[model samples]
Target: MWALRRAYNPLKRRGFCIGTSRACGAKSELGSCHLDEKASVGEAAQVIADRSLSLKRFYSTTGDSSKFFMGRRSFSSQAGAKSSGEVDDDLEDGFSELESPASAEAILESNAEDENEDELISEPEPSEGDDEDAAVEEPQNELELSDTETDVTEKRSPRKGVPSALFKAIVAAPGLSVHNVLDKWVEEGNDLTRAEISLAMLNLRKRRMYGRALQLSEWLESTKRLDFVERDYASRLDLIAKIRGLHTAEKYIEKIPKSLRGEVIYRTLLANCVSINNVKKAEEVFNKMKDLEFSITPFACNQLLLLYKRFDKKKIADVLLLMEKENVKPSLFTYRILIDTKGQSNDITGMDQIVETMKAEGIEPDINTQAVLAKHYVAGGLKEKAEAVLKEMEGGNLNGNRWACQALLPLYAGLGKADEVGRVWKVCESNPRFDECMAAIEAWGKLNKIEAAEAVFDRMLKTAKKLSSKHYSALLKVYINHKMLVKGKDLVKRMADSGCKIGPLTWDALVKLYVEAGELEKADSILQKAVQQSQMRPMFCSYMVIMDQYTNRGDIHNSEKMFHRMRQAGYMSRLRPFQSLIQAYINAKAPAYGIRERMKADNVFPNKALAGQLAQVDAFRRTAVSDLLD
Candidate 1:
């Protein structure tokens, strides 16, 4: 329907894949007005300003708020990895979806990696002082525990900058309140600066120390030694969403000073919604953003684009139409998303046209583009075209473009070019990055070169200081595909011996490995253990594995259990589990009674294939012999 609408739109003359059949309209107290092709960005912005007239009167601009609009857009463009919810849930749920991955907490908690590790980062103490307005004097009272502070780092704060030493002390003093830690630093005569505090939090965030990062933010807000900016509030709001949940984050928004709440803040909420794959919530937030008269940035648009790209692609045109109306420029991320969307529909011609338009806009395609292009080309069986793109990517000095090398390994392997994988990997082998090593292992595994994959894994173990569970999962994937259950188990042990944190990926790997070994019960048992042990819920993929196995055997009870467990784990937005449940019912030749009602509740509409099957099953709905006897 979106594509059809796009066809008749006036923008058809521009040859864009995106268009609006109706004139773009904005709502404001002044009344509705149509934005046409003649509408300049300046005019659109003026309309936005007028729309927010009431809020503007209450909270005047300091100019920084504008940065969040343009700044977030510019930043997202360069974040090729954010394309991953193409995977962070990247591009974690990257730029963490590409973790190859919130709600904000979902993405943040995910960005933080495995919830068990999150337990290491101290939750900020609930204090009257935590209310940004309240400034109680005694730090000890603010953190009212019988303070036998067990220092994580086991070192005293050195006589350095308070912010700098504070970072070190917090790392050393996990489980201790950050407010207390800051109190200790202040007592030792160290002064603090906002920049230093910002830098330290950046480090914590970079290392996935979201718990610690969150604690620091709370302490900063309580201290009130520094002024709070819109960005500061936005950052704290996002951290809360990450460590806490969206509900908590939403509550915190009201607590923020009215002037400090704006697009950046709501954008954070929208991103978390997208990360969670909540079509309903995300749309609510996006509409809320518009109603509040915020100029929709590419970050916001891209988040929506990413969301639709995953769940409801028909809505992407609506978003693009909104962007065009808003005069919001498309970033490389935007173009990349559009290209992928077209490719996903197998529209080769449409895809290339977008690429040409992107080039005409003077935006040079990067490694991520080539990677996506190769994938689409290969999927369309354009082997020669895919290879040509790969060749161009490999052109000139491969040494400068390490991204191309990383993208190449997997791309080459997909084409069954084992030798080409080797050639690119040989370049990486000289001084290996962790990701390159991961890619190399995956490539060899795809080629069924198990020994080579093992050698790469071994090299990583020796050279990479310490590897995370994800690193081990790469090799584990190879073993699982080859049905080498023994090796997979051995790798899990090695992971534990290395003191690696077991996250969803490891749990998924273990499930697949066991299931592939014809030990369905073991896989089910493993999922149970994961539910019990992991602070991070096991991925729905693991549940699907066990569910699929049970469905195959017509073990309806077990399949239903898996389905219920998946919803309990907060993975209800996806349709895959629902399909698995229905398939199980079908295999059992029983009507999937009340399934349509359940689907409606969950907002999952069956496609034509599923709908037809559901109709068949619904017609056969009857009380079974066992139920009648009962």
Candidate 2:
């Protein structure tokens, strides 16, 4: 009646359900024990005992345990005295059948006797090598290995080097397999604890071997027998993240218990969606985890910024919509990506709204932020606004920021603001790694402020101890533009003396300046030397300057020779030079000289327009004669 009552009870059925009884040979319940043929109670109890003992040992070996026995107290107490004795008999019978209880008892008893073993094993062991390589205390959840396992097993001898107390404690541990594996890992040169083991698995995942990493993580989970099932399942979920195979990774993730689903894995799937630029897929993944209120770490959320920054603008709206739906707060980098991309494309309209979004989100822009705005101002040709932004940056102590400074310098130079350029230079003087100084000096030269530029130039020269061609060329232009022609010439002499190869532009500037200043002799000398040093013909500008010099000095003879040479050299369409030549010839009062005799007998005479002008000159001679007659 009691077995019938217990069998019929729904709550008891779960625990009592078992295989077919031997006599019935078909499935039957405990209530049928009174039938003519049945297996004795003793035999039924034996199977239960055998299963319980095996499960207990298995759970003890690995670190897992279950609570199936917790709610069975009422059933155990209600059973008859005979059933009670049978249960105890079954427990002993299962233990004896598997292994000697004495040995198991001895293992358990010895550990309990030496309570000091707990204290010893609880302390951290040192690593191999000297004091320098000794292990440091790890963070919570970090794995640590035993010294004896790592050190003693290698020599197949006791490691006295390890403090005796720690070694003995490790040897005395009841779970021998646990002790051995820990020691073996140490012997194989790993001295990691559980927390460290997890970290190592994380490191392996970073190396892209997801399969191998998952196996290692599963092994760790099995061994640690983690009390928190979520932690184990989360780790396993992370390991399958890189599988590209069809549904393999997803299938594995689904196997994880509902309570164990990890946010990182969901985020990773979301990231994959973003990677393929599939915003819809990403939304689906996010929505599934929405009820869990899965919040991503800063590192994971940052990947969204990268994806948006790489893809075209069309995808940005979709990505933003997904983020909005998920309530995923965009990081500072997200705003930065938008600002930078928009700034680069010169899409100022987008930038305005982005800035407002950043402000509303309370994301403060850094130097990068200001630099992007500065770029927008530059590309749109808003020089004044660009300068204002740069000036505001300086007021905020950002002048030394290299990107902002580089952007600011060129803007000032473009506007020809020597005073502002000078101001930037003065501010740069205090710092050793000054980038603005050279740009500022070049700006000063462009403004024709040689004195102010020279002051900085000299300081940089003395302080820098070396000068590049850019510095030399800038200084040369300043000297020439300010009418310091002699000083400019001296610089050329110095370049020649120091074996520096002066380029054609610098030589052209020097020669043009001398010719402009009425120093034809100096100009000719420099031109001849430049030809020899450069081993190349002088520029057309050089020939033009020489021709102009001769024409201005009324040397029509030499001027015509150079003009013919220039025309032969293919510089023929020079109208102003031809006019200068005509003026020079008229001024020399050589109209009677045959045009053929003057221009190498080629009959290239002055045009018919000049014939009338020549007639006036002849009439002046006749008027002089008539005046004498009068």
Candidate 3:
């Protein structure tokens, strides 16, 4: 028996134990005692049961369970004494111990009972090496546990209007293919409502991510998820034109089914055309609407009316007559346009009749109507009537109406009523908008009250969080008008430092300052630098300033150079630049007849006033040459 114990001692170190009774009696003599396989199986079962209890105690004691389960699984596999089902059951018991409220002492007491029964099993205790391994692995286990807890918490918490998980998926979708994201979202058993898609599209549009918005709209349409209405289609079309160009918008419109081309879509396109001054396209759309028998709203008619008002006054009258023939009721905007047209033509009786007609139609005159009357009254030299109109507006709810106050300030300033300008300023100073502040500054500038203008400007800077280039330009003009050269230079420097994009107006004001201060070369240099640096095309005023300066100084070469640059820059659409050059040539005593030829080549015919000036210049040139010959 001692010899048998000595030979099997090596297997004992590997956790293989023989039952004491069986080993001493049956296996006392190696050949005489036969070992029972059933007894060995029973002994292995006892070893596994002892291991399971030790794991439970370890888990309960430390309240850290990963090590115990891992150790048990490894022990079972190495021993080959437990089935997978038994291992799984043991794992479940480990988990149950963790969830249970049994204290360390209670678990230890339960483990103590089994300790005596499994004495022959020799339950394993953790070694020094195992403790060190566990110490090293503790932090990693803690980190994984924390990460899992965070994921659970995030899933439990509510998100904003957008689901955080879905938003993250969408944002990350672009990194992958957008289609892949869409497919994954659909596969996740999630569905987006039409309103949700529309809101997402609008959010993208506001961020100027027009391409993304277009893509989302297309996706929604392709999936047959959204039944887009007329307004939605119109909005999409407008967005297409804004992001892509007019030509692309035209292509997109062509692709639209004829069934979807309704009045609203045409009206939206017509409005865009009007904004870009696309007269031919606007006419085509108007005619298309007429041919389609789309009920032409007054808004549509007014678009054409306003377009014609810019170039052909006769066409405006024709539009109104067509509207009457079509039986399209004129809106309040239509009546306002008529009043303004009559006012511009200086037909006061015509304006009054329109007002009466409006009132008879139950349309009370709005501020716009009163503004037109006041403007025409001022134009016709009826300042008293303009003042009465303003006083009447004041009697109504005029407070917080900064626009009316702005219009009145300029009229009072133009009439040289300094006291009235001050009164208007007092009424408008509270809650003044940017345009109102600008109007007040201009009025004070006209009244030659530089201090008052500066005060308004100072107040504007203090109250407003930001001022645009236009605001700075207006202030620069005030500084130049008052001959504050140092202050104007400082303003320019401050504008540059503050990173406000230097606009044409700012450049024009700065150049005017230099010209007023008798620095012609500096003015020209500044103008050139501004033209070079500005992303926008230089304004006609920028060119006119330097051209006038050079021509006045009899520098005809420089004047002609500047004029050619203006033409090359495609800014000669208006007649003002041509008039400036012709006047310059006449003043310089240079033969100015060629100016009329150039104007003709540019297809710019002289108006009555320009023709008279050209004729006078021609006569003066011939007379001077005839006298020299004599």
Clashes of each: 46, 12, 0
Q: Give the range of the ten consecutive residues with the poorest summed lDDT in model 2.
A: 132-141
lDDT comparing candidate 1 with the true structure: 0.60
Model 3 ranges off by over 4 Å: 1-229, 236-245, 255-257, 276-296, 342-350, 400-403, 415-435, 480-485, 511-524, 544-563, 572-630
Name the best candidate (by TM-score).
1
| All-Cα superposition RMSD per candidate | 12.3, 38.1, 42.2
The candidate 1 region of ten consecutive residues with least summed lDDT is: 136-145
The sequence of per-residue lDDT tens digits that candidate 2 reaches over residues 426-543 is 5676662323455455567667776766776777666654443334555665665567878877876766674444555456667767876768878877766765675434445566
**Two-way lDDT contest, 1 vs 3, winner:** 1
**Candidate 2 overall lDDT versus native:** 0.44
Give a tens-digit lDDT track for model 3, residues 1-630: 222222212234322333532342333232222223344344333443333212221112122223322323211111112221111111110111111111111122122111111101111121111111111101010110011222334323353124234344555555326556766787888767644454454334322344555566666667776786655676677666655645777787777777877876777677655544455567667666656667766767766655544433333533553455456666666666666656655678667777777776687766546666776787789988888887775656566565567566766776778998888788777667655677778778768888887888888778755555556666677777777889899988877785665655566677788888888789889878866875445555567767877767767788888888887765544455555666666677666756767776765555434555576567445666788898
TM value for model 1: 0.74
Sort by lDDT, best first: 1, 3, 2
lDDT of 1 by residue, 228-269 (tens): 777678778766766677799899999999987877678777
Ranking by TM-score: 1, 3, 2
Question: Weakest 10 consecutive residues, lDDT, candidate 3?
Answer: 137-146
Q: TM-score, each model? A: 0.74, 0.30, 0.56
